[model samples]
Target: MRLSELSRRSGVATATVKFYLREGLLPPGRRITATQAEYDERHLRRLRLVRALIQVGGVSVASAREVLAALDDDSLDQNERLGTAVCALPHGKPADADDPAMETARRRAEQLLELLDWGYDPATGATIPAYGMLVTAIAALERLGYPCTVADLEPYARTLGRLAVNDLDLVERYGGTADEQVEAAVALTVLYEPVLLALRRLAEAEESRRRFGRK
Candidate 1:
């Protein structure tokens, strides 16, 4: 397909496609002439992935480029590729280590991981964002005067662990290529996070209605 055809088929503007090509987000199409290039299905797929990352997943172009590079590295195994993708994705900012709430949350997070037998090194960059999430949640609960014990949070942790396992399984089994698998992982989280939260809110409302008449 020519650039115009590629743009039309992919639903991305020709100018944007050219920008992606120049930014190295999309691979160059085959050269047919000094000024003409022909794109193929691969280019279309890549353009879709790029759009999903930037538009849906809120990933920056630089981060998307890094993820694409990682996916394209044939030397990386499946686990490494997935790890690279996760690390490349956006994460919550880490809280200062010296803060008392952060320290407590770190300890609680470590305890939870230990109880679950999930070995994670605190120094790993991949684990930092997760730690930040844990600490933030814990701090929020504490500030609200509804601090939860480890046991109280364990069920939710177990459920999320199961969901995570299922998500990874689906990506590995159905995603055709490494790049596709990474894209699926990012898309699943980015697109479905709000859906999951909304479902939980609906469930809470339903439960309240069941316990007390809706008003």
Candidate 2:
């Protein structure tokens, strides 16, 4: 496919695609002429993954680029590469833990770690990425003086865990190979949380209204 077709098919703009190419996040296409390049389906797939991580997953361009590099590297297993990318982000920005404003932030990291342990699935045994993201979020919260607690996040973890189970079941229903399943799982782990969190909030509001016998 041509660059325009790749952009249209990937649902990303041509300029953004070029930016990705220049950043080395996406691989170079085969040059058919001095000004024309041909991309393949792998490029499309990679673009979709990159878009999901950045636009949906709320990752920075640099962090997303790191993840793309890890994913593109053929030497590691898919899960290991995914884990490396997840771990590579500057999620744990240091702060003055002794500062009153940072106390909550410090505790929040601890609580997030506890939540990761709490939410661990024995079957898949995948917990690192969630831990990485949660720690990062908590660190940001600390900077804002809004350190979260395990008690504060328990309801969220439970709600999100159930939704994750549903998503996992849907992925497994397709009945593909283990690698495909792992790939889908990695995609879901990275991509689904934002959408699920938004929908869950809506559901919680509706449920709260029903319980209160209000419209």
Candidate 3:
């Protein structure tokens, strides 16, 4: 396909496609002439993934590039490749536990993980990428006098564990290549967070209406 055709098929502007090529987000097309380049479905797929990472996932260009690098790395196995990309995403930056509350929060996070027998990639430590953020958030809650006990969090943890299994099931069943798996994982993780939050808020509204009739 020509540049224009690729642009048309992808619904991304030609200039934007060119920008992605220049940024190395999309691979260079085969040069057919001094000015003409040929592209194909592979380019289209990559272009869409890049767009999803930046536009939909709200990742910075640098972070998206890092994820793309992970997808292209052939040395790592499929799981490692996916993990590298996921870890590269700019999720909540974990703050250093410098204060007493933060230190206490870290302890609580460790306890929750232990109670659930959860671990990060090391398979023994409560050191997932978002673990620090979890600790920081819990510290804030405690400081605000709204601390959640481990018992209060266990139900959510159990429910989300099931969700994780379902999420991975979708990726493994439909995600084709290693690159495709990474893309699927990133896309699903980024996209569905808002879905989860919206559902929670909507459920809260419903529960409130049931408990105390809406004004």
Candidate 4:
């Protein structure tokens, strides 16, 4: 397809696609004429993946490019995948031992994880980085004695689990005959906490509007 068509179909503007090309995130298309290039299905697939990582996963452009490159690498092993998952989490410098806020969040994370039975091992079965992040955040809260209890987190966890099941079902609707779709969904699900965070913000905004009787 032409660049314009690729842009339209991908829901990304032509200029944005060009920016991706310039950044080496999207490979150059086949030259068809002096002013035209043809992008194939692979480009479309990759562009969608790129958007998901950036817009959904909240990864920086540089980090997303790096992770995409690693995903495309056929030689990547399980360890590489696990590392990628870790970096995709909400990252920051290591918390200082004296930082009270950070300490509280870490403790709350651990407490909730224990209550939720969320194992923190990255080498385990069906590892989900979002779960790790949530646990970590709860741990931090606990350290501050923020008064979060398992009962408080349980409703949230059940809601998230329902959303996850729905999201997985939606993936199947995309016709997963290809292995890449399955892989993408698996990776996406494992790293989906960012998306969940976005949803929570949206819901909170809407709820605030309703409470104030705003249209």
Candidate 5:
């Protein structure tokens, strides 16, 4: 496909595709002439992934480049690649390590993982940011006088763990190449996170209406 066809098929502008090609987010097409290049299905797939990362996932160009690098590296196993992608994402502000509330929350996070028998290591680059976010949220709640105990969080954790299992099962069953699988995992998370949050809000509203309807 020519640049125009590639742009039309991928729903990305030609200029934007050229930008991606220059940025190394999308690989260059085969050189057919001094001024003409031929793209293929791989280019289309990569272009779509780049667009999703920037436009939908809210990832910066540098971060997206890093993610693409991780995805393309054949040496990294699935877990490492996924970790690299997750770590490349933006995260909440890091709480002060010395803050007493943050300390408490960190301990609680550890306890919760242990109680659930989850194998995540907070020391890992990938898991640390998420664990840090969890601690920050817990600390914030405690400071606001709504502290959640381990017991209170257990049910939510269990439910999410089950959902995660199902999520991974579906990903495995989708049956793509290693790179494609990684792309699918990242795309699914980026695209569906907002949808899941919206649905949860709707569910909360319905439950609230059920419990506290006006007379």
Candidate 6:
């Protein structure tokens, strides 16, 4: 199809499509003539991924480019590709080493992973955004006098591990091709986050009512 067809099919404007092409978020189509190019299904899939990254995921163009590059990198295996793509998009706040709880929380995070036997690359430990985020969260909880030790977090880690597997199962069940799978992963992860949180809150409310009914 031509650019107009791609734009119409994708529900994105021609100007936005051209902008993505220029920004390299979406790959260029095959040049049929000096001025015209023909796009295919791959382009449509890519446009969907690009739109999800920017509009839904709320990532900047540069970050979206990084995510797209990571997703399209042929050298990486499927797991690595997904991890790289996920990490490429922005996440986590910067660490503050000066905080008293930071070091303790960091140590607890590391120890908790070890206790759970969750394998992770120590080389990438410092670079993984989740590490810093976990540390920050634990540290904040510590200052607030909340229980955030390894024992306190172990059940969450276990449940979330199962949740991650379920997420992958859903992705494979619904998504067809590799590109489509990546698109599904991004879409589901971002869009379903609030659903998960709301479910958790509702569950807690139900449990609280069972334990402490105020009739």
**Candidate 6 local lDDT, 32-109, one digit each (tens):** 999999999989988887887778778899988888888888998777888888888777567766677887898899
Global lDDT scores for all candidate models: 0.79, 0.70, 0.83, 0.68, 0.84, 0.84
* Candidate 2: segments with Cα more than 4 A from true spot: 88-165, 169-186, 213-215
Please tell me which model should have the higher lDDT, number 1 or number 3. 3
Q: Which is the leading candidate under TM-score?
A: 5
The candidate with the higher lDDT, 2 or 6, is: 6
Alpha-carbon deviation at 62 in model 1, angstroms: 2.2
Error of 5 at 84 (Å): 1.7
Total backbone clashes of candidate 1, pairs 3 or more residues apart or in separate chains: 0
Question: lDDT tens string, model 1, 15-62?
Answer: 999999999999999999999999998899888878977887788999
Model 3 lDDT tens row, 23-71? 9999899999999999998898888888888887789989989988988
lDDT of 2 by residue, 83-158 (tens): 6765644443433335554455445656554566754443443245445456556556656767566677777777
lDDT of 4 by residue, 1-215 (tens): 99999999999999999999999889999998998899998899888877877777677888777666666555666446535644554454444455655565555555656666755543462245554455556656666677566678888887776886786677667765544544466456635666677888999998988898645
Can you list the residue pairs that collide in candidate 6? none
Assess candidate 5 and give its TM-score to the true structure: 0.91
As for TM-score, the candidate ahead, 1 or 4, is 1
Off by over 4 Å in 3: 121-128
| Local accuracy of candidate 5 as per-residue lDDT tens digits, 1-215 | 99999999998888998999999999989999999999998898888888888898889999899888888888899988987787777665777566778888888988999888888665762256777788888898887889899999999999988877877777788887877778778777677778789999999999999999785
Lowest summed lDDT window (length 10), candidate 1: 122-131
Q: Give the TM-score of candidate 4.
A: 0.64
TM-score of each: 0.85, 0.66, 0.89, 0.64, 0.91, 0.87
Please give the distance, in angstroms, between residue 85's alpha carbon in candidate 2 and its true position after superposition: 2.6
